[model samples]
Target: MRSVFHGWWVVAAAFAVTFVGFGAAYTFSALFAPLQLEFAASRASVSAVFSIAGFLYFALGVVSGPLSDRWGARRLIVGGMIVLAAGLALAAAARSLTQVYVAYGLGVGLGVGLAYAPALGAVQRWFVARRGLASGLAVSGIGVGTLVLPPLAAALAQSVGWRGAYLVLAVLALVVGGGMALLVESDPARRGLTPDGAPPPASAPPPRGVALGEAVRTRRFAGLYAGCLVCGFGVFTPFAHLVPYALDHGIAPTRAALLLALIGAGSTAGRFLLGGLADRLGRLPALLSMFVGMAAAMGLWAAASDFAALAAFALAYGVFYGGWVALLPAVVADYFGGRAVSSIIGVLYTSVAFGTLVGPIAAGRAYDAAGSYLVPIVLAALANLAAAAIVAVTARAPTSSR
Candidate 1:
């Protein structure tokens, strides 16, 4: 009897890793109001907590990517989970917003930063033909986490208080994320198999492609970097602000929080359905559609007011957002090959880091000043359209060397 391929196990582990890490990180939506009330802070200030954490998690990918290449992904993933758990635990004890920033922002940011890229990159090394499917399945954890965790955290906060909720999440991060991290192996070669479980040829060369330096020098990388950076400005706006936006419209808190779950639901569908579809449709084209789709979704958000309309916007936005997350790494692998893929992916994500750092806080400040999310929502929509233009231009350019 044939044993199941080990790559699938790696994918499962990556899924769990992302689920725990991102679930915990994204639970900030549930914590946002509580923290704001507790700290007596302004909207932008509270939003900065998430922005800071988001920035670290994405930006740290540059360091974590290279480290994963040199030291293997498993250790970094395990260590990151531990750090994340500690950060959450410390956040539970915070007496001030600054402490919360130091505890949650630095902790969750660093933890996800350590684990996310390495885990995502490890999956890339294990499949070629089904890379899109596997990558989608692995990252669908984020969508799923986004669906499940925020509501759970909101419930926990109701029962146990927000600080206690943080503590509970910390334990979950340590146990679930850390245990799964153990299963993450860096490459298929270690298991005496090849990508997609093909029978190994007698003399397969090591994974070959351009080095990170050369890859970064290419026009393709520049286009991807620029597009992602621009897209980043709008990509995370909804995650941090959607609940508040819903609340301002007189939605009940519980139902408002569930709107994020709607996003998670849409995101999950997109990753699973669109991911497989991209393999058939051409990933680059599918990717361009995602940007366009998101642009339209943001436009819907700008016009939405009632629960039904907002829910529609959430689902649409999430679908495209999920596809964008699922496709970027796969697209990077497609163009650049496996060599230095993790490192290249890490550097590319810095564009997202800068955007994440600014986008949400800017939205919050816009809302505070204008007493409406209109300007930011409209801007976010335009940003996605700009990203679509950049990606379309990239599609016309020649492919980079492997």
Candidate 2:
């Protein structure tokens, strides 16, 4: 009888953790209108909550990354769950927008940052050959969370109001998240297994690669950093504004929520399909394809007006964006090796953080200032095209030897 590979267990755990964490973090968009109405805040002001939380998420991941390599992800993830729950609990009970900022923005954002990179990095350690597939499966939880949670959140909000919906998420974070933590091990070596469930031949280099500090000195790192920054920025604009953009165009609130679900739906498919593609086509080719698709999709996004148009945008955005997320950590492994996967990926993620930081807030401010979403949407389309071009150029650059 063959025992199941423990690496799969790590993937399963990562899936659960990302589902709850990203689902909760992204719930802000679903909750956005309600929060805005309740607080009597402007769109930019309301968006500040998610923006602040997103910044903290990226910044904290920088620290959590190296720590994941040393300490394992179990403790860090468990701690993240506790923080996430507390943030939700605090946000649920809050009487003022300021309190919501501290609870949801600072608390939840910080917790998610701590959990995300570490969880993904741990998976990188588990599989070498199937790296793309494993990451895609684990991160599909993020897309599913986005897809399922918003509609569910809308339903919950209808039944119990937004507060109850948050309470539900908080409880889920505590229980499901805690159980998942027990299954996480930073390295399969702790269980005496090599990557991809077999020993490498003596001639193969060890999966562990150069230290992050040294990896940063290479041309490859700079290209990856700059490209990811643009990718992150272009990707986040819609997540922050899509719901409101829909509502502003006279879509019902319930229908507005569906746009996010559509994106999530696209993301789920993209994660698995593109992940498989990366493995088969080579990471660079797969990445190039997704970036090109996203560039075209963002053009679709800018022109979206009707439900049909918006739905098209969601599906297109989801597929390309989700694939890009799944491919990245594996790409890092292709470059830097597995030993410091989290640390290296963490730094790259800060570019993602930079995207989340400026994209959402800037889009929000642009909408507020211009009294229209058209500017931001068009800008996002251009940014995506730029990112695709940059990544293509980087693809041609020489690989790092470090």
* Candidate closest to the true structure, highest lDDT: 1
Highest TM-score model number: 1
Worst 10 residues of 1 by lDDT: 393-402
3-30: candidate 2 lDDT, tens digit per residue:
8888999999998998888878877888
| Native-to-model Cα distance after best TM-score fit, residue 232 in candidate 1, in Å | 0.5
Q: Report the error of model 2 at residue 348, Å.
A: 0.9
Off by over 4 Å in 1: 399-402
Model 2 global lDDT (CA atoms, 0 to 1): 0.85
lDDT of model 1, residue 315: 93
Residues 275-362 of candidate 1: C-alpha lDDT, one tens digit per residue: 8889888998999999999999998998889899999998998899999999999999998888888898899999999999999999
- Cα-lDDT of candidate 1: 0.90
Per-prediction TM-score to the true structure, in the order listed:
0.98, 0.96
Residue 301 lDDT, candidate 1, scale 0-100: 91
